[model samples]
Target: MFVKYCTTLFAGIWLLFIADIAHAQQPLPDKIAANKAKDWQTYRQASIADSKMAVYFRALTSSELEAINSAKSNGQSKANSKLIEIKSELTVESSIAGFLLFLQDYDKIPNWLDNANGSQLIEQITPSHNIFRIQFSAIWPVSPREMLIESRYWQDRQGNVHIKVEDASDHYTSHKNHIAISIIKAHWLIEPLPNDKLYIQYRVIANANGKMPSWLANKVALRSSWRTLKNINQQLPNSDWQYQKLANILEYQELIQEPTSGTNEQTKDIMPSNNAELN
Candidate 1:
């Protein structure tokens, strides 16, 4: 349900080709300022100056790179250049049967968020789809945020479940006491292994939608990724969680509507310029 906006890990980062793209274009102020770039519009779309991304990327441990590469479904897209996509998975000491319930209990998601006020279903599109909302409190220098999300759950024949969520702009508006975010893309992959355990992969690519220093953006992205995985590792098993029985999930998979956005891509253009629109 994405209470993630409040989590300390998430507050700082999102899809960021803003990496070298940001640094390469804008030189770090000789005197590091406490504020964002003087010109985010230009910083968002400018030619490379030095490619600080390579250095930052090289700083990553080999394992991190391996995971990021695994998430790429095919050749890179515009998103891969300016955004940072994270892929992480953990083994849950539970059966697929036990885990499906954990996913269904979306209301409890607030317990998993960092500083989220709460989470709940705004509307259920079908057995497999829903419009959900999360409210975030002020996270320091940034304003509090509210997000209306479109999330879909699908269970395949093998019993694996795929949950996808993204920022949705149909009925929600910024006037609702929170900054309305425009881009928040992430997916949860749950695969049931044979030995009474589950393998979970949570991959995310996002654009925080406002503005902040690129350095801050990168730091936030890395920390949030690690923290999110750690929390899920602990949260799922500890909750007195149980699956809610409904129509067979197999049926849910077949009957669910196609992704409401009508797109199955993760990297087609995550970050656009000020005048650009998200595709």
Candidate 2:
């Protein structure tokens, strides 16, 4: 009971922080304010209206298709900037619970996290949200980049998990001799389907800080997203992770529900919705 209270308190405080961040930019025009309010309301109702989540993923898929329909490359973008948006989709042949477990188990994520240096947990914040120190190793001359980030996951009323992981280096010393990413926002939409299938859509918008060409950055971003998606597709169902079972699912659910256990890892939660509007 004590743990539950603390968990609720932390969650509530973080929600307020998120709200402050949302309205931080003042002088909002009336129309923009109205739209923001409408969007907030829609998100609040997302628990019950998971169709919004479904539509969101579908829209992203459609946007990717636009280039193909117009006879252009899928990831071709004329806007040359430091920031890039890369996305990929995958269908995990497992139950919703199993798919989520695969994500939450950060220590074991490298089993399918594509070709990368590695990822280590700084703190397991509420199973759904946690801090991770990751190494992004590229070819030589580029050196290796290390960063600390916080990933938070939330579930809709339909039992789908939406994830948002952002750079949290403000609290840690930046790694030297490597280009640190100044801005990175990764969003994931994991929805449950019939027959225990799970649909996942992952989108990443990032700025690889330092002197890097826009074309190269764009290529790396797109390739990384696609590679990760492909890895998950080929690895998760065939994985030997025990969390794939119903018993393990229930055990994990219990852990999330435990107030004391939550207290051990509770931290300021910065949800993805705080940074980007999903719909």
Candidate 3:
């Protein structure tokens, strides 16, 4: 009786160990599908907001002459002069799903971005809400050491994600010698595309605190936006490859349990190699 009990106990332990290994290797299909759906929705809203903002900005530009004339007649000398110095604004559009995938996998801002030296996560208030601090330095001439920036992300009632970035420190002096001199506002609309793709559009309105030249500031903003998109383009293909590999593994596991000839060998031969191909 003791020998029989020992055999049964050993068999039970062996079965449990095999079950754990199988569970670890399996991907949660339901979770992955839900995540992809959520990402698609985020990108869709961003696209609509981007279109509206573009029309509004263009109208503002066309009315610039009237604005300048009104300021001059009102004895607003400073405002009148500033109107002529206004630089062209920058805009960037991308796939929302791709950007989110890039962010989730690559959290380090400076790694994929150019002219971004120091970056750190400041706080995590909740799963969806987090604060990030970043420092940007000049690429050419290397004038200032760095510009300190703090950013926050939150979701609105419509399930849209909004991100805001602001200057956090007063290392450099503004006209009033106050920290309020350096403030920037940016908005992003993230949407999803068919076939696991995303659509992301970004709009930025910056108030440079009279320290940086308007033209130079605009260039910096444009460069930063391009760098972010370039990084996403580079990172997305790798993600697709990973997903395909997981799917293949799941298919193989299901097929092995069925009675089949050596047909599986032929299928394996036709499988494509996992190469890093970016679109």
Candidate 4:
């Protein structure tokens, strides 16, 4: 009787252990993956909307200045020069579609964008292309005023979306210092990832033709870029349900392929997403 009891007890323990392992290795649910994909799509749309607003503003500002110049040439009267002193100093891009979503309402630009005081959509050129004009107010030490910015967006044959921005402040006269600056060029590329996420990459090469100091220029570039990224990260979640699910599956797969206990060097080498291996 004692021998039979011991065998039953050990069998029960073994079954429990197997059940726990199976539970840990279970795959993620389908609903979680769908939700995560939807969220990523929203993020990307927002980014595209912001770029469109920038492009539209740039063109409008340029046209207004041209009209002023044409009037002056025809002996209308010298226009105000102080308007030219204010500069548009910030450019931003995001992989999340949230930017475009905000644009649909047209009143939320100032809320999400750091320095934008006001914005308006001038035209809808196409389903993929749009034009928007934005007026940004200086934060401080820089005069508080609005400068026009224009932006354009289109996808290439490779399905890569590209955004181009133009600054139209050059056409107007600056009453403050007769200085003018224009956006030489800007680009934003969105790369889609697994589970509908996107990797956003942005690059801008701008020229300041005004008599501004080099130190100030560098400061603006660094501060603006850092602030934009910080804002995006704060707004977006790092790990949604789908991300957590994927991580769990990956960890389980790793364990199954090399089930070992203790400070095993071999296990460390096979670990996924290990930074040590790259180093």
Best candidate according to TM-score: 2
Answer with 2 or 4, whichever has the higher lDDT: 2
Relative to the unseen true structure, what is the C-alpha lDDT of residue 210 in candidate 2, on a scale of 0 to 100? 52
- Global local distance difference test of model 3: 0.38
List candidate 3 stretches off by more than 4 Å: 1-98, 104-107, 140-142, 145-160, 164-181, 208-210, 237-279
Name the TM-score of candidate 2.
0.58
Please tell me which model should have the higher lDDT, number 1 or number 3. 1
**Candidate 3 structure quality by residue, lDDT tens digits, 144-261:** 3333445444322222334444555443222222222233334555443344343455554444333454334433444444445555455444544334322111132234364555
State each model's CA lDDT, in order. 0.49, 0.51, 0.38, 0.38
Order of the predicted models by lDDT, top scorer first: 2, 1, 4, 3
Residue 40: error of model 2 in Å?
24
The candidate with the higher lDDT, 1 or 4, is 1
For residues 1-279, write the lDDT of model 2, one tens digit per residue. Answer: 999999998899767644543342222122222112222111111112122111111112233334323542222232222233445566556565667667666677666665467777888757566887767775433456666788777654334567777777766665566555643447787766654456777766555655555444544554455456656666667656524553212232444455652222222232334533654
Candidate with more favorable, higher TM-score: 2 or 4: 2
Cα-based TM-score, every candidate = 0.56, 0.58, 0.43, 0.43
Shift of residue 242 alpha carbon in model 4, Å: 15
**Alpha-carbon RMSD, each predicted model:** 15.7, 19.7, 27.1, 28.3
